[model samples]
Target: MTAKDLESLLTIYKEVVEKIDLGIHVIDSNERTVIYNKKMREIEDMDIDDVLDKNVMDVFHFGPAEESTLLQVLNSGETIPNVKQTYSNNKGQEITTINHTFPIRENGVVIGAVEIAKDITKLEKMIQENVYKKGDTRYTFDQILGNSAALNEAIETSKRATRTTSSVLIVGEIGTGKELFAHSIHNGSSRADNAFLSQNCAALPDTLMETLLFGTAEQAGTEGRPGLFEQANGGTLLLDEIDSLSPALQTKLLKVIQEKKVQREGGTEDLFVDVRILATISEDPIDAIAAGKLRKDLYYRLSVVSIFIPPLRERKEDIDLLTSSFIEKYNHLFGMKVAFIDEEVKSYFQEYNWPGNIRELEHVIEGAMNLMGHEDTISFDHLPIQFRHKSSSSGGSNDLEKIEGLLYQPDKAILPLDDYIHEAETYYITKALQHHDFNVTKTAKALGMSRQNLQYRIRKYNIGKNTHS
Candidate 1:
């Protein structure tokens, strides 16, 4: 081609390259830049005049410590395809890109490399702030109901839990309102207005979970998107089912807690965050540790201020209050006018230990509300047959509870000791029988009494099945 024709072709190519959205860069055998297009300037957040004819690595390495893709290609004489690069440019702006680098060859002799990159920093920022948005928490301390001492103690612990940004470990069974406590703690903290994000450690696999909690450069490109910890910066992150987190994730979490910084899955920079982590596990800490699911050091770090929510069965005295609260909630939810609960229903509730805790109580009330026809009152017929027929506790526990209540009766002082003893024994035996679903063999075994002896007592006391249910 003629010199003028070649010059015209080169100018046209440069214009076309600069017009394209992707970044185009080239270097000669001496590692001096041959091309730095307009899009490359925008991507690096730098000026065109400063970058042209410069070493790509020197210009690209702002604060990033990892080796640059162009540097690797230049040294290895190999073509590197789809290399994810994370770096800050001369403008001090973080940049992420997928680079395709190829060695320029003359008759099979390696000369230089050409790098083509796509800026994904804008896309990542959009995803960080918009798509995977960190939202405001809708839960607070007022949502946790129950005035019983045991429940109150837990609430008070939550109150204290909210006073600091230290990591917390909430231990409770399923449906025990562990998430509520986490929310309350976050909302109560100094960072309440910032952001709140939760991740169920058990809900995701190790690879996905790592990217979600700590973020990854593979998908987000060089300057990757923020993970949950970064997203909840200056706020709180709730890690539910923490015991279910794989060993690898558990180790990363422990490192985050200890170092107060996180390294993304592919990025080299350690991003510091002011996020408070609140981890929850349904199983006991000891059990989780013994089972090798929860690391002991991680447990110690998370439980700097541990809070245990008592199960419904252990805090039976709170049932009446919780039931009333749930009744009101369901009333509004189901658009019902349940102004009162039948005393019979109350008796059934007090007797039926709730294994699912507050959540179960709410569900029961919801089911009852949905089942109610037009009555202004809730009755035994409204309750699920499961709640009515089955005792949440074992026969021995139900009988023991009955005996305790009997001992505390207001008129116990007036009754003769012998009569009181007989009355308590009869009441406990009946409860035992009921708890065992009227199975004489199971009830007798639970009470450590002979089946014949229990039957005799039942017949003598006239403990009919109808009398209990």
Candidate 2:
């Protein structure tokens, strides 16, 4: 072939090599880079001047990985195909890729090695973003509202817990806002910019749980998809109802938590994962251990910073505030202005024991809101039948007799006759309500007043403060 023909052929080859999207590096057995392309520079976020005609190892830092495929291929005269690698280049840009590296041989002798890398940094980033909503920060510390000493102490502890990467264990009854604490902690942490994932340990079987939490290897040429751990790489994972895990699974979880790495199913390498583990359990820790439901070793590792959430009944002082907040929430939702909760209704709420905690109270209020018609207040008549009977059954005729005998003359009679009559009328109205079994509808008729007038008087005097409707 003529010299001009060879020159034209060389130019065509250079254009083809430069246009390939994958990063390509060709190094001779001596380890000096002979061919470097624009696509390679783009993938590594470096310039051609830095890597062109330079030593391959000097331009790319490839340690921390158990083996370097290109370095191995150059020395062994063999092929290494589709090996996954995660490392930062000399330019300080982090990259993850699948490399097809092998030797280029001539006359049955190894001449050089070529590395073609498929960049996966973008794909992994996309997976992380998928777990979280772009604009939605679901929960924050401000959302958890309460003022009791126990609740306030827990809140302060939770705020401190968010600043560290240590494991957190939230202990509470079923509906005492364990999940809310989990979300708030994640949002408040440095991992707020990354993903946040939650999985209920009881929601899946032990075998399936392993695959879902650690990840599964994909079929054929595609790479394995990330699991909850990989997806929440730099963020938090709430293992809700973690006591439901079997002892076998508990052992596995302990290893993952300690190692800070996960070995995917059908995949050989242990991928390093920086995930914050936040776990929730409903049972008392001591009782759970005695019952063989929660493993002691696993609990020790997870409860590095433990938080105990008090039940609603224990924080009764906040019941009035919570009721008002829920009322406002429903008012905007249902387009109804529920002015207040009746005095009789508040009394019953204070006396009853809330076994199901705050969640049950919210449901009870929501039920009353749905049943409310034109009335602006939530009365005992609007309560669910079960809730009404909870208080009425325990209260009986003794309460009425106490009110009847409560009528007492003022120390000094008021000079204004109208004011005196009003004071006396308020007292008589209270007696009539107790006589009618604390039923406002029945009491109004017996007192020869309209139902609206009886309600007005009850509010005016703050009457029936201790009555159960």
Candidate 3:
């Protein structure tokens, strides 16, 4: 390529990065910002001039216990994907984002780091202000879908929980709607008229969490702020991801639960609080205890009313209902008239395990809806590339049947040798794409070819375009 061509290509890449919806921040090994995209500036509420050529720690006021994910990845030379992080900028504006930070390497040596962030600050505020606001939880028992035996049993247990103010521990895998159940319990109880608040134990450092839970005392330079316990007095307080709390914090929490009071940091007096504690742990209490992630005394106290929500794979019968619900939800949100999914796609959903549970199914439906146009129904082709690839790799019966039919049908005309080879190559590449979830880099690695070569073949065969159809 000529110098002018290279320059044009670079310009195009820069424009694409700038215009992308996700915030992109790249830092050198020395921790100086190299590329802070427009979206990143908008997300962080900072000017490019404030970030570019500046140390990330200098720009963001990270506490002593907290570290930037970008810097962590830079030093560890590892990828940290899909992590929810909450931090404040230098101006004290708190920001929440889901970041995928990766280490940039050259010739097998770590050089710098890049972080792609999706800002969720507004989402967090909405949850705190509206969803978990006083007497205004958006979810109730009626909103908990799925009639599977396991789910129904859990629902029954949760319903019983609303009858008493004892601490309840909700145990389940991630994305199992533990918070939804917590909201339902709060809404149904006698304390339903009071404030309902929630805080994720894993989202902040211990010191910050300490202040957030037990308000700080009025000191000479700063004013006193009521914590979630005080704010949620006479109501319900949900401590989400409770297993992430340190033992010391757990002991403090136990004291609050037992004494029905909170003594603010640096304060001498204990304020009485009638807040009912409802905690959620993604792992079983037994497992969490064995793993030393939860205090035994705290576990026993919190499990006065234990509710275990079954994983999606365990409640396979609910997949169809959940899928329909998600479809309806996205249709209204996307303003698309998707009637239903094809039987094959439904079967694929049933057969495949949803590790992310209902949330994953909902996301799959949402993702497929994004790829739709005038189509009223979601077919195999409409499914996300990841789902399609997983289905192919699982060797579904339908796939095997199709292959058997193709081979056994003697009435079908045989193609020339070159034509047959071309068709076979297309099929293999299409399956490879499915297996790799349509990731060009991974597919190339598995196929023993360069990514450029795989892209050329993908274009030549139009692998993803019509294969699903």
Candidate 4:
């Protein structure tokens, strides 16, 4: 290409890099910072002058045993993809990012490196506050609001787990109160006075998970942070969705449980921790193993005291008790005296399959209550459209009459076209959800829209509330 053409291309490349949502940092082979994009400045909370033309080590501090991703790639001339790194800027503010770092080479010789970073500082902090923050667990045996035989059996077994420090694995489907059981076990244990922290394994990438679980060591004037294992010392640490952990992490977890010691992510020193580990899985351990999502040896190690909680479908009898509890809870919160669920609504609840389980049922009740107004009961109409129109035989006449009323009433004020379109879209989506038996994936496919787009519309329109009459 000619010089003018090359200049134009370079200008376009710079513009695109600056406009990109991800943070971009480029450093020479000597680790001198060269290109720091606008997004990178925002992520690191730095200005262009703060980082440009400076050595990376001078701009950002890494732990003694750790190295900058850009430097690592520059030295090795290798690409490192999807790596989560935690470091501090010159201002001593901590930043966490998932980075894809690549070497810039010429004729098989490394010249420089570029790092693409997605800032996850806020996300990491949120997860840490959730799982590593020191606090007393909220749930105990008395608070686990179910009396079904299946649930009670699981509770009894979990209570047994409190008597020993052996690892306990609570297995149940989503919304089956597996975390509740974990908390109850911890509260009932001898170490109740200590911390009870929990982490959802599925909530983070493997790199972040590793660092958060094991922690980082202090080095080179930077402070170190404790991982979950250390934070829960002399207490209980619950790893929810344990099966979501990668094979490598599972093996490391097994070693920690067996050795009763944990080494931080970048630290050479191993710290002994007297933490009782509790874990939960949303599926059968055997099934997870067969599917290659879980490690067999790790399962054996964690399931020393296994407690299985039955799904809401299996324990349908508890629906009344759960329904009453939720109603009372919402009643107190909403300051509305909803006296009962109409028999038809109760019957429909029993007949419809709750793919989302207890959580789904609870949300349904919540949504219905939002539309209750001064009504004394939750009726067929109060139920979300998905549930109200599940059976084709029901609501056909009423739905037709409601649409007719909207279209034919000359005395009614004309609504904005946008409002009419909004209502129509809501009605159509509800019909699609009903046709698909409330399966979001199937409905989204049938509607030729993404599931996320459909979900956004549902929330935006409050589609379930009154179903527009």
Name the top lDDT candidate: 3
Q: Where is model 1 more than 4 Å wrong at Cα?
A: 1-135, 218-223, 392-469
lDDT of 3 by residue, 109-215 (tens): 98999999978676556446533668568899999999899999999999999999999999999998998999999988999999989888887767657867887
Can you list the residue pairs that collide in candidate 2?
none
In candidate 1, position 291 carries an lDDT of 93
lDDT of each: 0.77, 0.80, 0.84, 0.82
Q: What lDDT does candidate 3 reach at residue 277?
A: 91
Best by TM-score: 4
TM-scores vs. true structure, each candidate: 0.59, 0.58, 0.61, 0.65
lDDT of 4 by residue, 1-469 (tens): 9999999999999999899988999998778988999999999999999998999878889977667889889988889876778899989999988788999988989999999998879667756477644455788898777778998899889888889999998888898888778888888889888988888898888877887888878754345778889988999898989999999999999999999999997689999999998898988899999999999999998889999989887888889888988899899999989989977577667666666778888888998999888998898668776655453324333343464225557877776777766766777778767755677776665465788898888788776643221
Report backbone clashes per prediction.
Answer: 2, 0, 1, 0
Q: Which segments of candidate 3 are over 4 A away from where they belong?
A: 1-131, 394-469
Cand. 4 TM to true fold = 0.65
What is the descending lDDT order?
A: 3, 4, 2, 1
RMSD in angstroms, all models?
Answer: 16.7, 19.5, 17.2, 13.3
Can you tell me which runs of candidate 4 are displaced by over 4 Å? 1-33, 37-123, 389-469
* lDDT: worst 10-residue window of model 4: 391-400
Clashing pairs in 1: 85-222, 96-223
Worst 10 residues of 1 by lDDT: 126-135
